[model samples]
Target: MGLDPQSRVLIVDDFELMRTMLKRALGAFGFTNFTEAADSNVADQLMVEATVTRRPFSLVFLDWNLPGSTGYDLLCKWRGNPRLAELAIIMVTSESDREKVQAALKAGANDYICKPISIDKLKEKLEAVGLGKVRSA
Candidate 1:
């Protein structure tokens, strides 16, 4: 199932490098409608703007640990908001403990990808959880 190229994807990370890497990975996979935020505050703002504008985002790739609010906190915030809770969230982080992954899943991450993400892995995970917004012929 191919995702619509017009659909939106948001990337949240404190490091510009991670954001750039994710953007490159997704772009390599053919996802065109993408947005990035270097911090939790900006990320929250994006979510609010998207929701209030009634243009709910399709996918969000978030870092597990951020400067202030952890990605888990942001996930909780989004999950608490009914309108935003429905959005798909994928956690991208360096932590890969089974317990942490389980906790994130319990907290409502649609899926979680550990640090050093791979293009093929991202594609499979996105598709598995419905972020496959673009595909090759």
Candidate 2:
């Protein structure tokens, strides 16, 4: 289903159920190496504290809504940094705002997907972000 175990991915969502859902969906999509953070603050901390020992998340499925800041804000924060410039981020949220999508792309989101994501669509999204072969259903 996936390419390797060392391909770390991060899911950032403030809501517990949403995070759980994403984790489950990604697992179903054959991504075992994954982690989660509740909000942007925690996500930032996780990125900052990361060392060379552990691989930085190559793929990030970020939630558009968060407690302290919107996902758009987080994208700006992450994208502003040179270290995370090449990171591939996919904004996964319920909000279908076109303006938000435009901003995220400008701010460095590689792609955007709305919530209630299906397994096949998620796999395709991942493939677009540079991952395993995406099988059509």
Candidate 3:
């Protein structure tokens, strides 16, 4: 099934521009709801809030480098947490290193995207993760 247009997605990045970019990219794919975090701290708080509100985020586009903990660190924590274990997390980073990719996968990232990301590539990753292909309007 295609990703729901109302799916609550979270964008976690230290850079405001990157968050904006990802949000815009997702918007093109029919996503309409979003939450953004500038660091791991904010991400954690937001996740908790979402859980309490019973509107948990369905997807997360996470940056590898952040002010506090790294995306890998957050992924590992989430994977270990019962409430967040099922969250679909995509590591969005500039790192193209094979080892880093492997580490993120091991840490439990649902997917990974390199920096300077293209809409097509992002769509492909989403589809690969069963978010469904973006249908052209």
Candidate 4:
């Protein structure tokens, strides 16, 4: 299935500006539903609550660094849970090492995007993950 404009998205990042930028980028692609978490604990809680409420997030933009837990840890934790396994999670971070990318993929990240994120790159990743057929900018 392609990207649904109505799909709920979670933006997990410690920086408020980063979250706003991500949300703006997604908005360009017609996505309006969004939730923000400044740390892993809040992110995890929101994810579970959404799932339990039958309003699970369809996608997540998770940062690599956080106060309590790293994004990789969260990724692995969610992937290991059957209830959260299907969430399309994209690791959004400053880490550009090949090993890090591979590790995130191995841990079950649907895609990865390095900062400072470009709209073009974001669109490409979204398309690759079957989110949608994004038109060229």
- Scored by lDDT, the top model is 4
If scored against the real structure, what TM-score would every candidate get?
0.91, 0.86, 0.94, 0.95
Where in model 4 is the C-alpha error above 4 Å? 135-137
Clashes of 2: 0
How far residue 17's Cα lies from its native spot in candidate 3, in Å, is 0.9
lDDT of 1 by residue, 1-137 (tens): 23454668899999989888888888776777888898899999999999889887888998988888899999988988888756889998897899989989998888999988887778878787765454642
Off by over 4 Å in 3: none
Quantify all predictions' global Cα lDDT against the true fold: 0.84, 0.78, 0.86, 0.89
Better of 3 and 4 by TM-score: 4
Clash tally, candidates in order:
2, 0, 0, 1
RMSD values for the candidates in order, in angstroms, are 2.1, 2.8, 1.5, 1.3
Ranking by TM-score: 4, 3, 1, 2
Model 4 residue 112 CA deviation in Å: 0.7
lDDT of 2 by residue, 1-137 (tens): 23343567788988888778778877765667878899889888877765344567777888998889878888888888888766789998888888988888888899999878887778878787776564333
Candidate 2 TM-score, C-alpha based: 0.86
Cα lDDT, model 4, residue 18: 96
Clashing pairs in 3: none
Reference-based lDDT, residue 132, model 2: 55
lDDT of 4 by residue, 66-123 (tens): 9898988999999998987668999988979999999999999999999999898889
